[model samples]
Target: MTVMMMKVFHVLLLLNSVWTLTGGERGVSCHFGKICVFPCKFSPGDNILIHWHLTPGNVQVHSFYDNQDQLGQQDQQFKGRTSLFLDQISEGNASLKLTGVKVQDKGTYQCYTSTMEQEAKTSNINVNVKAPVQKINMRQTENLIICSSDGIYPEPHLSWSTSPPSNRTFQNQTTVQKTEELLYNINSSLTLSDREDELEYNCTINTLSDQRRASWRRRPSVEIISGEATISCSSPDTPLSGFSLVWRFNQRQMIVTKNEDDEQRVSEEWKQHVKEVSESGRLTLQHLSADHEGTYTCEVSKDGDSSITQVSLRSDPGKGNSHVVIGIVITLVVIAAVIGLVVWRRRRGSKCTKSQKVKKRENNKLEKSEDNQDEEEETKMNSS
Candidate 1:
């Protein structure tokens, strides 16, 4: 019934008397290899207590000595892996060090402390044991291949597979430190085979989160022409579970699938017109004619974001026959005229030099003569 008890009881009553603040709080968080401090500052005689516990209703991970020995059952997953920086506790350091972290270590952790007057206040700590983002750096180590994934936590697994999903040889070494937390360093390697599909090697790092699996992909690549004719193909960096290739000829459409209905009638349009280099995404047409011109698009996709390329094929390189030829010739002539004007301007003016003036006058006369000749030719052609 004292002032403090009245206020404490009132606060606890309002807090549902759980003596704990459950939701809506800036909880505890730490990177795998870094030191994370869980604040647990309580007045010496506040009748409040603090400790750490796990779910499935377990005992404490560790707690500061009220003045003597530490108490509470440390989590098994966290056993021999965590240590309360006991030195800082007296000065208010509730930080814990988690060592040799694994991918399974990421989760929501709690920091609970009770106040006899009020209620138990709990803070949440989110520990993220991130797997290294597989970095694909291709290297030829004297016929032995070298690919690495740095800048990651909890050393990751590196793998190489063919598109048809065949296992290959690889070796990896992981180094870790408690002082550095779970800041894991891994050097994985395997004697890569010298295959014709060398560039088709894919490296992936696997990790799990919330019962979901995830990965990154680096697809094999090739550059192809847009039109006339080109091959839309890739060897692939990783093995594919399934495979399909299609060529589309809508001129505007970029994907065209092969006809698969009848077992015998398999030859499509592009196949008849274009020949591809075996086992590669390279194509060659027997002859590139004007009519064979249209946008030839290549579609390549695996997992997500299939790529479609627009290859512009030309029905006619510029325009068509005689009229177009004449028009082009006229255009070229106009462009030359403009270029001559610019050159003359830069030369300080055609009028400034006597020789230039003479050349200009001669050119004007020549132009007049050329116009007359052109008119005569046009009249003759029209008559013919």
Candidate 2:
């Protein structure tokens, strides 16, 4: 009898080990404030029961039995945020759906299932919650450009790169701070190279769930010589897939917009000025006058992140001609002043020459009169 009991105990331990090996822990990643699914399954059977609990403390997260959810004992923190796949429970799907996930929900959870025909079984899942990096704010101050984003989870990394590739290394300073809600915020600054001209700067933020990038290029003011002009919305190297482009005039008036599908929409007020929009989001304006001279901004948006480019327009058909005309008038004035100076100097020289000739004639007359007087005195003395 003792040998038979030992054999039965060994069989039981072997079965338990097999169960533990098959129902090991798995991982499920979820974005913060988004829906998360914990996948589990078992052999389909009648009288199914499912219960999900937070491990280490056995806090009830969700429960189901008798073909309906039983949440009376559910933790208050998971109230209204947890649900089970009721329709698929009969098929052995015991997955739990969690909505509005928070940092507090990140931990190990146990899914307990049982049926009248089969013994109870448990599966463990580790939930990892993260907040994706989104909406990178970028700005330039002098030679320094700053890139920043907030409300991220699990921390984030920031990097800087230049277009047209530079061999010189740039100075970068980055900081990550944890918020009171256990989320993270990242800020990075890059020192721009003074020797680089028209070099595009790109900033990228990376997280476990998502990565976002933004690019900035300083453009010189556009000069429109004729009555028409074309303003490019994006750089040639910029990617346009899955992006929405919008063009605004002076930051107030919406001129045109194009979606990812290439559908274009033009504003009613700007229909007269908007000639056409190219496939690459270049805006063509016709009948452009001085009124059209202002800042034209192009905004490219995807998901929740955006990049912006601005073009300043100056329209004046006669501007170049006016400059030329002013130059010509200045040249003519200088020429006229030079001619007047030359004529004045010549007239003064002629006057001085005439005065010298008149003085010479007066000296000749005085000499002739003195000679005649001396001859008359010599003749009188000889006669006496």
Candidate 3:
């Protein structure tokens, strides 16, 4: 045999020795619409061949052969979504980063790496894509009612409903947006009736595997300009101890917290503005300014049940209260005037009835006299 043949035989023997050497299968969890990485590492070299395949069909996802990436046979579903750490490949890192992970991508992946001598090392990764975190929000401006949600996956479906059926047709507007992190953000709006009474609104977000719903009913709005503002979240009287209250601003910054033991904590930025923390989870902010205008969320937990309440705050404090008072006063004055007018009409109707009765008696007396004259004329004719 030639000398090259002898070296080839020795390398083949070495490959057979380490062929069964492999790490245990690892479990990987990935969020839907997010990036998922399957880790594989080895000694850095250019003579290594890495092959990745998905089980159940043994579909080739990616392959690095002959010192180059060979992807002509990659599955269409994983096209453009699969990537290898090319920069670190020379350093023996064969990790794959999969972007925009979907439910269909959940399965077992095999990483097979072989050196120039055909010595092989294998590793298995079981990937699971998780559902996205969801949150729903609602807002109202004059006659417009809007509902929105953020950080959802798989293109969520949104719908709106009302408690009492309204005959009026609502204008619906919906939009879906993808963020830099590959999460879906949805916004939907419905124009509401101009009714003064409180209305019940329901917003539902649906995914293929999960469905979450949120109900929002109209609450009495309070506005204060340059004055103290109070937001409250209270529950029914329960003997359960260990209650906790948390307040958030605009769904981002936490403003205050009160524990069941009556301990209080406030945010540093809002320390001066936070005036009081009631035992019932009421937050009072003093010396409010335009900067305080936003949505305030109050979360209360007792026992094991939790409740959330959101309040919208604005800066037109004086106008809102004054308008309410003026509207009440105007309504009261109009009602009083209507009552006075009704009383006047009743008195006039009574006087008119008395006058009609007197005229009717006079007409009856004249008719009787005429009838008496007619009877006397008839008697004289018979006697003649």
The order of the candidates by lDDT, greatest first, is: 2, 3, 1
- Taken over the whole model, the C-alpha lDDT of each candidate is 0.48, 0.81, 0.74
Worst 10 residues of 2 by lDDT: 13-22
In the range 29-57, model 3's lDDT, one tens digit per residue, is: 88877899999987665366777878768
By TM-score: ranked, best first? 2, 3, 1
Q: Worst lDDT window (10 residues) for model 3?
A: 232-241
For candidate 3, the per-residue lDDT at 9 reads 53
Candidate 2 lDDT, tens digit per residue, 47-81?
Answer: 66677888667788998876799999999999999
Greater TM-score among 1 and 2 belongs to 2
In model 2, residue pairs whose N, Cα or C atoms come closer than 3 Å (at least 3 residues apart or on different chains), thus clashing, are none
Stretch of 10 with least lDDT, candidate 1: 209-218
| Tens-digit per-residue lDDT, 1-384, candidate 1 | 565674455445434423444643445434544445544453333433345654324335665433433544555666666667655554544555666655556665566554445355565666555544533333334445444545555445555544455465444443333224444444444454545243344445543421111221222322222333444344332322243334445433333343223111224554555654333333455445555554454444444223333334443334323455788899999999999989979787545687877889999999999999999999999999
